[model samples]
Structure formats: structure tokens, C-alpha cells
Target chain A: MELWYSEMHTEDVKFSIRIKEQLLADKSQFQQIDVFESNEFGRFFTLDGLIMVTEKDEFIYHDMIVHVPMATNPNIKNVLVIGAGDGGTVRELSRYKSIEKIDVVEIDKLVVDVCLEYFPNTSVGFKDPRVELFYEDGLKFVRNKGSKYDLIIVDSTDPFGPGEGLFTKEFYGNCYKALTEDGILVNQHESPYYSSYAKSMQRAHKRINEFFPIARVYQAHIPTYPSGHWLFGFASKKYDPLEFDSKKWNELGLKTRYYNTNLHTACFALPNYVIDFLEESKND
Target chain B: MELWYSEMHTEDVKFSIRIKEQLLADKSQFQQIDVFESNEFGRFFTLDGLIMVTEKDEFIYHDMIVHVPMATNPNIKNVLVIGAGDGGTVRELSRYKSIEKIDVVEIDKLVVDVCLEYFPNTSVGFKDPRVELFYEDGLKFVRNKGSKYDLIIVDSTDPFGPGEGLFTKEFYGNCYKALTEDGILVNQHESPYYSSYAKSMQRAHKRINEFFPIARVYQAHIPTYPSGHWLFGFASKKYDPLEFDSKKWNELGLKTRYYNTNLHTACFALPNYVIDFLEESKND
Candidate 1:
């Protein structure tokens, strides 16, 4: 039988690569994790129904997700990452010297184990002393936690099947309760071009804004995502993401694939339609 | 007969809608232009195997293409747009009172006519006396033109079939020769995620950089385009895109869909891979 690695950008759109072996498949978390060495795009890891990384373009997604929220808050010593089993987020988050602890809550232990075995580079940083792995439901873990985190990063899958609840208002409210004072939360919202996803994101942002003092939506261009254009929601109690210190970001000297001080500010400048949605939702 | 409006996101992937009628089809141009009223996405436009617009998301692409270069060069007066048959660029450009004259060079009369009829809102400002239409090849028009333009915008199709030559060294050289001393040139480069188109864009930028003193690449989140992430190349004889007069842009008071002062500066911040490409090309 021919083995292939596929990333379902949408229900109808799936990008696939023929593979020589089934590196790993984990069904417990409702995700089939696989590692495939390809002739063209390089060795890739697919979790749930998405292409998480290849040797070529892994940095682009990793850097933007971690650095944007971290740079926005200078005192983010404690970080919580939900659903990043490939360890790419941990790898990037480890660059921050001020980050004392990174608690990763991934439901699937198989994804973590497969990534460690096949993708050494992505898994290398997870062995750091600052890192703690908890194999459990991200939603449940956040709801039960007593201590608050400085930053919460939701690097979950698409809003379908197992990851569907990730886009709900209830999940967002639980996240709000899981953060400390002056805490900031960033979640990977869907593509704004697709109205279905954009609508869901807007609804989630509206719900989160009620709990947090400020809620803003930002954008990043990731080619592998549904529309190539992806949105992220940032909710904070006291800080505005645009008012970060550029000098501090520069001093961090983080060699990143995408995120920078200029981009950190620019990402928050939403298109008029999005601003209109926020305004329209406010009247309701 | 079932009329379907199919937007080819890539050779393999397409976002299609079943339509009831052939609203408008222009065959004079190399690509067939069609506008149809769809059940889900509203009125949509497709050209040369690509999705140009839908009633809902047109503002995002149109505003970013026009406002970014205009905001970058605040003193722009004489503007020249090549291949903007839909008049979206003209509509956005007319928002600036600083623009004294706007000339558009389009190869297909049918595209202009169809857009004028079907997309009336987008095509409204083209009737302004300051705007002049030229039904000619943009490449040839620029070569023979005697007048120097303050801003030149190349809103052409993809780099294959009819628009292939637009992404050439000769075309960029002519564009350099056609501009005023302080003129800025902005053209839609292909998505960097696709290697074939990305390499072509890299070559075009490499050649254009040899002629213009400063050349840089920026991105706009365009969903219809291949890889959904689109890139634009800006070449200037004088004036940096980042060093813009924000006060002048604010005075213009253009209600845009996407382009803002913060995004105007931030879009130029490239990822490490793109930066590395430019650096490597510089050495060669």
C-alpha cells in the first residue's frame, strides 16, 4: 500500500505527499501523527489534519506564534502552550531568557514521542529544564489549574472534530480565568478571507473581550493554512500589543523566521472589514 | 447549462461556486473574465484561472494595492496604473486630492467594459476627468511615453500566459526609465511560497534593483492568490517606503479596507527566508 502524508487545509482541500513508511499514527487524541521524508518539501510532521512543519518553512509559523505574544509582554516568565505536540513552539519559546517555565498541555503523548523520535531538531529544545509536559485535554487542564500564567498560547488544530471546542466562547472564558493580572492570551484564529472562519473568530473575540480589558485581532501570512492569510486573537488585561518596546525586542537578538518588532505592531492593524465587524458587534 | 464560477487557487485546488447565469465574460484578453452572482459568496469575478474579487472581500485586495504605495510617497501627484482594467485601483487612487492626473493602460477593452457594467461601484471613479484610459499594451505604452509619472502601479495578472512578460528584466528596466527622479514603482509579485513563481519574482527584483537605487519586497494577505500569501515589489529612485510622512497620509483621510500607516511601514519587514534570498542573490 502507498503511504502518503496529507494536510487538510479545508474539508475539500488536502495537500498530500507520498511517503515510504508510516512513522507514527496516534488515534487516541483524534489525530494521526505522521513523519514522512519527502523528495521535494523535506521531512514533515502532520498532526490531526494539518501540516505542522517541513525543514523549509517551519520557522515561519513557529516564530510568529511564540514571539508575537512574548514580545508584546516583556515580563512573560510563565507560559502555557496548548496543543503544540511537535515541540516547535517550545523550541522558539526557549529563546527567551526571562521565561522561567513553559507548561505544554498536549492531549496526545504519541505526537510528542513520534516527534522526538523522527524530528529531533523540533524536539531538541523540549528537554530544557524550563519545560513541563502534561498529556491531557487542553481545555480541561486550563479549567482545573489554580495558578495563573503570564502568557497562554493556543496552538491548537482547526475547529473540526476534536479541535472544534477550541473555537467556543466557553473555552475562551476558561482561558481568561487561567491567566494572572496583566496576563495576555493569544490564540490562532482562522483565516479572515473565509467568512465562516472569520465569523467564528469574531464571535470568539467578542466573547473574550467581555472578560479581558482589551481584545484585538491580528494577522499572519502562513502558506499552509486554509487561506494563506491567518488571524490571531490577543486578549489582555492591561497591555496594548502595539505599545511594545522595540529596543527590548532588538536586545533579545532572537533570530526569527518571521516575527519582528515592526511586524508585531503591524499585525494588529486590521483591515476595515474586521474593524467594521468589531464595531458592528459592539452595537449588538 | 450549469454555469460555475471556479477560482483556481492552485493548479490542483479550486474554490468553485455554481452560478445560474453567465453574468459577463470577456474573451478578448488572453484570459477569460467572468462575473457571476453566487449563492454563498455573493458576486464574484474570475480571470485567467484566478479569483479576482467577490462582493465581500474586494476591498481588502483593492485598498492594499493602492493605498500602500500612495501612503509611502505622500507627495505623489501624477499617477500611472498599468493593467487595472477593473478600475478598482483608480477608485482607490482618486481618494487622494494630491493626485492631479491618473492614467490607466489596459490591454483589453472588454475587461474595462464588463467591469464598468457589472462592478459599477468599483468602476465609478474612473469617470473622473483626472483619470484617462488608454487601451494599449502597458509595456509598450510605458516605453513610448514622454511624461514622467510620480507613482507607477502595475496591477497586472499573474506571471504566466498574458502577463508573463510583465515579470521580466526588460519590463522593469522600462519602468525605471519611465519614472520621475523621485518616483516609486509598485508591482504585484507572485506568492513566495510557490518556488517557481517566487524564483521569477526574485529574478525580477534582482534585475530591477540593479537599475533603481532602492528595491524592497512586501506582502499583502490575499486569499485568492496561490498560496494565499501574495508579495509586492517596490522599487524607487529616491524615497524609502518606510520613511513616509504619516501626517500627509492622515490628512488624505482615505477610508481604506486594509492599508494603514502602521501596516504601511510594517509590510516591508520580510521573513528571514526572503531576506536570506535577497542577501544570497546580492552576492551572486
Candidate 2:
């Protein structure tokens, strides 16, 4: 018998992967977490039935998220990552020798615990001496922190459920207050393709735009996402990502699979429909 | 009670769309042709269980394929499109007043007949005075031609079945001979994420690279396709797409939903993984 794990992209669209076996299924306080083995994607874990990381393509997501901001401000010494319980974000951040501290705030300890057990490769960054893990709601963790982090990565889930608060105007305002002068804020901006996700993307971007001097949107093709067209929001206080020094980043010679200097520039060049969507999203 | 249309992306992965009704199911001498109506994608047609065009996102595919080369060299007066039976490619080409003639050679007449009947918006370009439809095999049509056309677009299905010859070395060699000195050749180069499709992409690019002085690959996020990360091959005898004048194309003021001056330049900047894949493909 074949066991197929399917995710409803929309109510009318579905993506399915044939799995070898279900490895683990358990409930955390925040969400239901499950792990499965598949031939096409290797091993993957999900939160509340939404795919978090698949072994085959997790590098694409992690590389884009961590490297874009780091490449923008190579002097980024400290980073605050919110909701990346799978530890993929932190793993990429630990690669930079210039980075002094990496603080990960994951509300669900069980998500971390299970990932460490089942996804050792993804969770390997936890072993780094510069990294620290905090089990707390990201919404509350940044409430009092003032001008602390050089970069903030809101590596989150869908705008509903536990991730809903992270997309709020208040949360962005706090994140702005919690960052340094040259701080960069990168978050998992929802896709512009589907109507529902586009609304969330619009809402989050509009709020972030209110606080940041330089706010831009970029895209990557992540096949497992709601639409394969996944977006990232890059909001900065002082630096524009487009004007970043590519030579400085290239001198470091980090072997990356997805993020490169040329692609970094290219990713920000939005399609006309997406540009229109983001433009209309501001008014909405 | 529920009807769904699913295409196996790989043996282990599938993409499914919920259908309101199956509009038509017929077998041409080439392949099985089917059309379906859906709430999400509106109306869509497939060949041998593969999606050709969907009303919702057809603009993305058509916009990228037709506008990129058109923008590269705005003086392009004539184009030869092979295997675009759905008529989306021809429709995009019809937008340019500079384009005097568009000769489309489609092997299957049924794809054109059914699409014109079921997908009026997609097939609308056939009504244009500039477009000339030839229900002949594209491989045979290019055989004797020598330096006749400015642009050749292979808007074909996957490199299998009736479309197989279009990806062969002989066909590409013929296309090379069938172009003007400043001629540009673009084709569906397949996806890079999946191994099987990547091999096809490699094989096609390897063959095309052998014939052209400037052969490069570009990408677009087409969600309904196998990986949503679809690639396009752009080969030319004279012009490098990167060196093209954006201001010249922008001056045309063609209102498009997906293609724009910025994206035209940006789409050519492919990911490092794809670059490495193509590099390795040279030896294979």
C-alpha cells in the first residue's frame, strides 16, 4: 500500500508526496508536529500539517533567509531568530565567523526536541557555542528588548495560528525598537499568487513598511509551499539590500547552493503582477 | 462526489487540481487531449495528462516566453513559433506592432481546434492578421530554412512523445540554420529541482549550447508545472540578453501583467545550484 501525504495549497489545489513511512506524530502545546520519510524529499517534518522543512530542498529556504541579510550587512554580529524551531535558520547563521551571538526564540520546545531527535542535520547548529535557545512566545520575548540585535529573522509559519501575532503591527513596531541602527528584518512573507496568502502578505508588508526606512520584497521558488512562489520581506533601518557590496560577501567564500550575489540582486526584481499586488496591498 | 485531476510530477510526487467538470477528452494522432473547468485556475487543458495552460497563471508563462526575446531586440519583425497549439505564445507575440509576421507550426490540429472552442481567450491570437497557422511537424518545417527568421520559440510540451524530436540535436541544428544573423532561439528548458527533469534540461541545454555563440538559461515560477521552478533556454547568434537596453524596451510602454523591464533582466540570474547543474551537464 502507498501512503501519500497531501497538503491543500488552497481548498481547490493539493500537493502530494508518496511517503515510505510515518516516523513520528505527536502534539505540542502550540501545534501538532509530525515526521515522515519519503523517497522524493528524503525526511521531512511538519507543524500543524504544514511542511516546515524537507531534507531535499531545506537548503534553498535556509540559504535565502540567512544569507540575504548577512550578505547585506557583513558586520552583523548578533542575530535574533523567531519561531525557527527546526533550527535551519540558526544553522546557516552559525556559518559566519563574524557573528558573535545567535539567539533562537521558539515557543514550542517540543518542536525543537523532536527535530533534534529526528532531524539531527537540521538541528546541528544547536551545538555551536555562540547559539542560545529560548522557549518563549516570540511576541513577548521582544517586548522589552531595545536596540539589541543587528539582524532579526522572523522565520515563521502561516499568518494564522501561533504565527498570527508575529505579523501584527505592534510586533513589527517592537522589532523595529529592538534592532540596531543598521538593523535588517527579514520575515517569511506569504506568497502573492493565491488570494488568501496575498492578503496576509499585504497586511504584514504594509505594517512593516510603516516602521522601516527601506522595505522590499523578494521571491524564491519553494515547491512545497502553498504556491511554489514564496516571498520574503526585507525591511531595514539604514541599509538597502540592493546596494550591498557583493565583493565583500564573495571574499568570504561561503559555498551556497541557492543564494549568490547575482541572484540576490535578481530576487528583489519583482514581477509586474507581484509589484501590482504589493502596491495594491499597501492601500488595502 | 468530488472530481480531481492529478498529474504525477515524479513517480513519487503529484500535483492535483479540483475540477468542476471535465469539458473534453479526445485522442489526437499525437496524444490524449483533455480540458477541465475549476474554481481556482478557471479553465485548463492538458495533453497526455500534463497541464498546458490554465487561465489564472497562463499570463506568467506567456509573458515570460514571448516578451523576454521581444524586449531583448525590439526590432524583431518576424517570429517562428513551434508547437504552441494552445495559442498562448502566439497571443503574446501578437501584442507587438513591430512584429509583422508570426508563423506557428503545430503538429496537432486538434489542440488548436479544441482550444479555440473551449479556451477562447487563449486562442484569440489566431484571429490576428499577423499570425499564420501551419498544421505541420515543426521538426520537418525548419529543415530546409536558412537564415529566414529573427526569433524562434519552441513553446512545446515536455521533451517526450510527439515533442521528443523538438529537443533533438538535429532539430536545434536546423533551428540554428533557420535564423537570421541576429536571431534568438528560446525553448522550454524544463525544471532543475527534480532529477529526471534536470537530466532532460541538461541534455537539451548541452545540445543547444553546442550550436549557439550565446546560450544561457533563465527561470520563472510557473506553479502548475512540474516543479513550479521552470526554466527557459535563450540562445542567440549575436546578442547577449544582459547587454540589451532596458530603456529602449521600457519606451515601448507595453502594459503587461507579469513581464516588465526589471524582471526581464533579473530572470536571467539563475540560482547557484542550477548554474552548477548546467556546468556539470556539459560533460554528460
**Best of the candidates, DockQ:** 2
Model 2 chain A poorest ten-residue lDDT run: A275-284
* Each prediction's DockQ against the real complex: 0.42, 0.92
Give each candidate's fraction of reference contacts reproduced: 0.49, 0.92
Cα-based TM-score, every candidate: 0.86, 0.99
Best by TM-score: 2
- TM-score of chain A, model 2? 0.99
Q: Write the per-residue lDDT of candidate 1 for residues B199-240, one digit (tens) a residue.
A: 867777787788888898888877656676778888899888
lDDT of 1 by residue, A1-284 (tens): 65555554433334455555655566654767666676545677776656777766677778878888888888899999998888998999998899999999988888788888888888876998999999988888889565479999988887776677777778888888888887888888777666667676777677777888888888887776666777888888888887888898889787876777777887787766677776776566
> Worst ten-residue run, lDDT, model 2 chain B?
B248-257
